[model samples]
Target: MTLSVTPPGTSSGPRSGHRLAVRPTRRVVAPEVRRRRRVQLTWALMVLNVMTFFPGAPHLLPIPGSVGKLIAQGALVGALVMALSVNRPLRVRPSVYVVILMTLAVEALLSSLHAEFLLGALFRACRLFGFALVLWLLTPWWTRRDLLLVRTHLLMLWGIVASVVVGLAVAPGLAMTEDRLGGTLWPIPPTQVGHYSAVAIGLTIVLWMSGLLRRSVALVSVLVCVPVLLLTHTRTALVAVLAGVTLAGISLFTARSRVRKAFAIGLVVFTLGDLTLGSVVTTWLARGQDTAELGALTGRKAVWEAILAQPRSAMEVLFGFGLSNKSFNGLPIDSNWLGTYYDVGLVGCALTVMLVLFVLVAAWFRPQGPHRALALFLVAYCVVASFTESGLSEASPYLLELTLAASLVYSTPTREGPR
Candidate 1:
């Protein structure tokens, strides 16, 4: 028997009831749509990750107190999953800032060997390690997707800000204690509420000036966030917001016409505010504190002196007593450098200094853009706030903000000339 061959130019039909195989055409998604999807996914995961760290979140949402530990761990697990899901291999240089943070995490674990509260310190150290690991694991995506990374970060921040506002409206009495705002629902410290508001407001202005966000939106954010910020009566947050926004906006003035116009309008608004609200503002800043208390930096100076005066072993001075409750004799340290030293000692303090300085120097040289402006604002805010509040060397909002800034700096393509 002989097989028949199909002739050239002849249409071939199925033989022996066998169908020809067909390769399906793949659907092509638009670049913008894909970017948006990535950003949204990142935003959701970031919200979960950030919620774990936000001062009052675990105390209120998804369960409170001891049960909150599970939620925090789950969030990190989700972050690890997200980080491992990157579609492509990263080819960027290793981020020095990230390395330093990872080092700090290892140091924290080492320092915790003799902590006063062994369990608490170990738990905190583990969380710090998880945070650093998540950040490092996601570096490939964050470095190439800078725009999406920061946009998602801002969205996470705004979510917290909105929660505080809603909490205030829902229960003014619970939100305000002694005239200070701390959402009754979340029950966060008034200072944390103020921190979120101040950061949101500052970043909104910077993103707006950089044309990343709309003017109307930024204006609305400031209008809403300011009230929450003011109600918290957190003078440190207020000062930091002013300094951060001012420095960030300055970077955009030359490139963005809106910045100059806004600056002029702001000057006018400030002048009128000084004229009409000068006494009120001054009184509020005073917060009923006497000169002696104010001179002592609201009693922080004494705490600093006490910390410094306390004798320490050679190893203790070098490594510290390990992380505690971030307090001294039942009182909060209220200072980043001091707290870092108390928790991790002089070595931790040096690493913390490097963390801030590296970001500061990178933002100084980075090309002017929304990312740089944001980096500038976050770094400046952390710097100002560090002197008055702790958390620079630990898994806190300030640490996250600094890490975000570092990612922005490293993710950006560098120029031949420094800004």
Candidate 2:
């Protein structure tokens, strides 16, 4: 006897007269699907922040420049949070929010006394909201997959930045490194190389240490980039990268003394490199000395002194001079506390200091899996580099990336299972 078997969905025997009851196709939502949704929302916010670069025009408004940027950032971040939490409740981390508010208050106090258009700085400050928002969206909650995605983006950005720097270095009659590398255009200036290299090296170290990349690729990248860093002659950049990578290595390999020793050896080589190349080091050192005059050949020390002599009133000291002081063509404003003090005042400077401290602490203390050490290094290096660069301002590309990365680092969550 031959028997025919009907498919579950198809009718058989008496069931042929009725539509068969097909069990509903169960929708199995993988955990990754939910995670991807969060990632998408996070990336969308990042894209929006990136798009602001295309807008070109400085967003100056009555809301104050920093405040306006803040509004824009808040809008994007708020949208992202809302989207991510259709089912899950979205709660702001109190410490993060407090830091942000303090930063704004500092900006506000500075705005009241700023000599130039304080609104410009205000807008700039506001714009950074995106950076902070990015932290909230990506960190502590970020999975290994999300980190991989971040590494991909970072590597691409690093390649582009590196190519730009190298091309400019080789370009004929570029005149000013800052003009070509730090300027706002197709290629940014080298002004914030410290911040840029810090994050790059930090990420590289994280990937290598975490065993995320094949040894060959990581080794090659480190080799190629080291020369570029040297050629750029960005002392602060080197410092940032070394500090961050070393700190990260220390934190990540706390139990592995050999690895820490290796990292220390690398740092020694990196630092002593300038000494080995005697002529180059001497020349760069000479140039640095020449550049130290703060005002009228006084150097930054002089500028700081001049600022110190300004006034004693709490309001004047705290709020600042107001933004309408001086306007320069092509280049953005100077990178110094003097400029900030002259424009915004003591309160602005204090807030600025606090903001830097906050990021460094977060990087230093935040609970990331393998990335904890790396993030700390990046944050520390950035803080140190900011002393000489236009950190926390749209003027620096590296600052933008570092801030973005920091935000992401903090926002991402740790992987649940053991390594």
Using lDDT, give the best candidate's number.
1
In model 2, state the lDDT of residue 222: 69
lDDT of 1 by residue, 1-419 (tens): 98879898755676676678899999999754664565356436644554433444323344455555465557767765655544234333478988899899999999998988899999888878887876775555455433666667667777777887777777777677688887554546788889988888887888888887877888888898898899899999999989999999898889989899999999999999999999999999999999998999888888899999988999999999888768898788999999999999999999999999999999889888877888899999999999989888877778878887887788555321110
Error of 2 at 407 (Å): 5.4
Indicate the TM-score of model 1. Answer: 0.84
**Tens-digit lDDT string for candidate 2 (1-419):** 99999888756665545665689898998765665555545554453344322223212122344553554456466645644563244534445534653464446434643434556655554444445444444443433534644564456557544654555455524414432233222323343333444456567766677666677877766665565555456666776677666676777676555466677887788688856887876676354555434133324444445556855567666666554222233233345455556555666666666656666676666664455655576566766666655444232343445544455455455442111
Error of 2 at 37 (Å): 7.6
Error of 1 at 219 (Å): 2.0
Every model: Cα RMSD to truth: 6.9, 8.2
Best prediction by TM-score: 1
TM-score of candidate 2 on Cα atoms, chains taken together:
0.63
Model 1: lowest-lDDT 10 consecutive positions: 410-419
TM-score of each: 0.84, 0.63
Off by over 4 Å in 1: 1-64, 87-93, 144-146, 411-419
Q: Residue 100, candidate 2: how far off, in angstroms?
A: 3.8
